[model samples]
Target: MPWFPEFSSAAELARREIRIAGQADPVAQYFTALNEGRTDALEVVWPGEVVIHDPRAGVVRGHRELRTFVQDNRSWLAEHEARIEIMASTVVGPRAVVELLAHVRYDGREVPWPMAVVAESPDDRSVVFRTYCSQWPVDGRRHVRPPVFEPGHAEPGDVVGRHLGALASGDTESILKTFVPDGYVAEPIGPDYIHRGADELRSFYTGTFSEGGGIGLQNCTMIDDGVRCALEYNLIAWGTHAVPPQAGIAVYERSPDGLLAAVRIYDDVEPPDSR
Candidate 1:
């Protein structure tokens, strides 16, 4: 059962509390298959090749690999006692991005891990899922993420455009102006890295631009519903150091007054200076 917008109306989707309520969303079904350790449902739904690019398991292709991957992740999920909370979702053309905030036991206590899963259907015959998140919450280490999508030409507008533009030029002050006085920038790791207000954001951006350049991100797919914008991109560089192209997704929340309310990143790209 797929709950695609093409089958349902936008008004109806807005009425639902959670998008994964039924056996609809393919991404939801993927998690269900992993949690329950089953693969028959996935085959029945797509009946074609299913590819998954996970942070830990790497690339899983076909049902054979998916079965093994599901079993392994199920055991890990049970051990961690992950309580997944549904967040917002964005749908554009063949791509559907669903954000999940899961609270899992880590280092002796529960930590909220923000993750996003992208489901792209090239046709009715296949589906590609690429998940984005910082592994720091789970293992306290950042892994270098490989690029998932090639560079795209989706240039966002408004404050998101300003933020990205400022970052591309390494203009710390201009980037800072894109946010409201009390806006916050949250790192992908966890809530522990959220930088709020002007002073804290200033401090964070100052260090961010200390490399003599801003964070280099290549624009990709972006879905902006006027209120919240979800951008999937490949991180290309970190200041002066050229990094391997890596994939990441960011959700930008806009304030009512046209400034950014919050910016949340989900990626494993570690800084060059990180020690």
Candidate 2:
């Protein structure tokens, strides 16, 4: 016999609606929960297996730690009178990268702190955030941080991987070989410091090698799409000075020929023991 399907009760329907709303854009919900200091809402969007790798708080897993991290972060922002201004956002596949400027009133002066967050959702039930930023803007000094990820080697087929290998080798020709003829590299600090083309890149790489023959990268996490790769690394050593390791993030966009077309970096790491 033909039969009618059972319908959900009003209360059940309401709960389903809430779940659908929460899943609309989990990342947006994440930021909203942080800004509002709403741990309940955060728990709704963050699965039990959620993880956060933060510079200040280190790595936090599970719901309890995440709740504490969120609350503490909110308190810290409030204490510093900090406001986040979103500069840009780019999403590729299941990964999203957001660039923002943290405006904080410190020492009776307002400072713009550059920051970036990479959000990755492996499935509907899991997500992770890797935040990158310089600590100088907040405390007026560099705060050393422990490694967030484990030491790992890059895949051989990746162009950015080859570039990192060249940097570590301190081979100028090898480094340049990974870049296109008209490629450009943007430093962490100023906008006017961009090095473009072969001659300019040669000079920039030379200077970098002069300061530190090779950079020791630790705890690296790379997010690579077909055309671009976003890398987060800890600069453990540079040159002769074995200074405290600092965090840095860089985005490398590749040309059609598989060479690096542009490299953009974000960090506050100065030369070894510049302080």
Q: Give the whole-model CA lDDT for all candidates, comma-separated.
A: 0.84, 0.73
Give residue 242's lDDT in candidate 2 (0 to 100): 71
Count of steric clashes across candidates, in order: 0, 1
Worst 10 residues of 1 by lDDT: 14-23
- The Cα RMSD in angstroms, rounded to one decimal, for candidate 2 relative to the true structure is 4.8
Candidate 2 per-residue lDDT over residues 154-181, each given as its tens digit: 4435778788888876777788888999
TM-score of 2: 0.74
Task: State TM-scores per candidate.
Answer: 0.86, 0.74
- lDDT string for model 1 (106-202, tens) is 7789989999998887876578888999998888888888887788888899899999999888897898899999999988988789999989998
Residue 84 in model 2: shift from native, Å? Answer: 3.3
- In model 2, residue pairs whose N, Cα or C atoms come closer than 3 Å (at least 3 residues apart or on different chains), thus clashing, are 212-239
* lDDT at 41, model 1: 64
Q: Output the number of the TM-score-best candidate.
A: 1
Model 1: pairs clashing at backbone N, Cα or C within 3 Å? none
